[model samples]
Target: MQWIECRVHTTHAAHELIAQLFITHGANGTVLEDSRGKDFTPEPWTDIIGKPKTEHLPTDGVVVKAYFPDDGTLEATLSAVKKDLVQLEVTTNQPVAQTEILLTTVHEEDWAEAWKAYYKPVQVSETMSIVPTWESYEKRREDEHVITMDPGMAFGTGTHETTLLCLQALEHIVNDGDTVIDVGTGSGILSIAAAKLGAKAVHAVDLDPLAVQVAKENSEANNVSERITIEQRDLLSESSNEQKADIVVANLLAHLVIALAPDIHRHLKVGGKLVVSGIIKQKEQEVIDVLKQENFQIDDVLEQKDWVAIRCRLTEVGGE
Candidate 1:
């Protein structure tokens, strides 16, 4: 019951990518910290304004921590992580900024219990507040939506900007009895959010089997399993039961968003909405150009730190 906490200190250039790399190597929990100190405002995202801010926070870069097994594969896993970090530049076609990696040994219970100390309820939007499964939260507003989740080994806890933006967008657009298809539905956060926001049925898909299972579990925990269908599949794959949806959400890397652009109409009804996130601000224009070519009209854009989540609508069912 021990783990190695791998901390990567790097600029905003590829912070999320580095954290995702840790998850790919079987890391259990990921914590990303970027000191936006004096500018910290949880407004619209959280109601805890009196919350104390950390002192001496790093101003030079972001610190991303993830838990990996201290088992015999440490050397091999660490080596592979390093190699992947090096190739990030080629992967994103953007130069990887300077980075520093730190390691520490921690008992499983110590870090697992750490969530209570740091992870608090976040009001992702005017209607939704993401509460940890263990925390007992009383709604501050009658119309607020509360989503309780454990995340397990999957991502999207609503703490990340990409997920928060998507949750917020869903609050404004998802109508009662609407059908939603969530691509790259990690941890089933978006699917769960869409269901909670009144979507009648949801199709959540992920290439990672673990993500698929965790998402299914999350849907059940949220009491929305009856409304969600979890599957292990790639993006936009043709399924015998495939049906068009009123909304499609893909919180994946920017490059993947570009690749998904051309085929989006196949699964989305005309005038259906597409919510895309996990995009760094630098790649915003690149993604938008691709979507435009496919006849998508931008509707709204939300930003947090170096990340952005965009909501666009399809003007035509088929490509331009």
Candidate 2:
């Protein structure tokens, strides 16, 4: 099968939003390349094949490449994606570095395993690490927790800064025997990590069916399927009034996080913590304002690159 690869040239600040735009327009997966040289770290024993020369790396911006089926709607989807990118730039008051969209044809056989070369074991936090199923990573310590996952087409593989920040927060927040609610649990990474951290039960929910399915598979692969309940539901929509959790983690877009603030507060116990990510540094204040309005007390703020993750607690009275 042939696929249409749409590459967007943008800065690190705008890469996440641009990739999300592509995903919303029917792209299955996205590969991000930045000039920071972070993605070029290769394993020692692995032989380099078809690796790009240092000069080929972009020096000024990031390239986000997303794959879509070569169907008749490819052009329309690309047009919509580009329009959304432009609108995003205008709304955020930040340019995308380059407005031109690059297109290429990729054969299924050639592109299937190409991305695996870039996915190595990532140590996201002190106690947690994300290991791709195909990668061999020796545990560095006795207390280290390794989460084995293959993201497939879903998100949250622990590579993105948002995911890393969320994982780091979870490392400290998820207590043993506590109940955890993971909103938009892509690839079930957070849910699995929660379970591995000794959470009594984990409820993982996502609006996208593909994400729910991928999360289920990943949970099983990580041996946490029995502890996690994966469902295709919007954030806190299907949650019952009695279904309060000890911890609620949401690694969703900033706008979605703001919209779900009230529901998140409702679904958590009186003093439950809410760990939220996927927030750009520029829009961090907007999200913080909404969270405060919803009576969530800000606890700790974790920032990586241009992204920010907030760990807040739902106040008992939920007000001033």
Candidate 3:
């Protein structure tokens, strides 16, 4: 089996976003190379393939390398990726340091196992940790909430700055017997955490079919499938006449957050909590402004690295 490696050179700020773009185009795995990677701590594959070369990484930028199966859609996928990268730059005002999308052909064994080294037991908050299915982790504390995850082709590890921020915000807001809605629920990590935190029921929705499937599997793996319903739906569309939720969580980009803000009140009960994450540093204020316009009262603001998550409460129902 062969694979086409799409290597993108971009600023550290855009590295994660670019990797996400590749995933949206069907890249099964991604490896982000940057100065911060020194702490990756490779183990199993290190002895087999030797330590990954870190010294040769671009001095001024991060390299996001993604692997797509060379099973005949390379031309179309590559074109789509390029087009999206351009739109991303315009949509979010994200600076693209390099435009050349470098491609390299390699064997399946080259990356199939290497990327697993990237995921480890990451304690997203004081009470919760994301442990990959391929890893062995004992509870740090008796009450520690362990979420078993294997994102597969869906492309989230629950450890990115945006995800970490959302996890923390959920910890502060989710309550027992509360109904929750998670929009753009990649890998269903947030939904699972909400269930563990006592949310009576969770409706997790994502537009990506792969994400929907992966999330359902993760939910079942964490033993919270009974409480969480995973489905593929676009939250950007009109909301259905379903039961209002006590809380809503969206770990999506800033533009989507802005576009989805007005409709959020529909899914949430009056004064219900809203946990929003995945906003890049540059667009934080833009998202805040949008939320405020929709009658959301900022309850808390969480920031880490270049990402921010806002916890808000629906002040009052504007209308039905």
TM-score of candidate 2 against the unseen true structure: 0.86
Candidate 2 C-alpha lDDT tens digits along 139-250:
8789988899875643535666788789889888888999999998877888999999999899988877778888888888888898899888867877542578999999
List the pairs of residues colliding in candidate 3. none
How many clashes in candidate 3? 0
Better of 1 and 3 by TM-score: 1
How does model 3 score by TM-score? Answer: 0.83
Highest TM-score: give the candidate number: 1
When summed lDDT is taken over every stretch of 10 residues in candidate 3, the lowest stretch is 42-51
Error of 1 at 30 (Å): 3.6
Ranking 1 against 2 by TM-score, winner? 1
Best-to-worst TM-score order: 1, 2, 3
lDDT of 1 by residue, 1-320 (tens): 77787877776767777877887887765776776643676754467523434553577667787877678888898898888887987878875546556789987567556555656676777888778888787888788778888755335356677887888888889999999999988789899999999999999888777678888888888899999998888777753336889999999989889998888888998999999998999999999888988999999888887789889999964564
Per-model TM-score on C-alpha atoms: 0.87, 0.86, 0.83
lDDT of candidate 3 over 4-99, digit per residue (tens):
888888998788688888877788667666765554442221221223345645666788888788889999998998899889899879777485
What candidate 1 gets wrong by more than 4 Å, as runs, is 23-29, 44-46, 49-57, 87-100, 153-156, 238-241, 317-320
Worst 10 residues of 2 by lDDT: 43-52
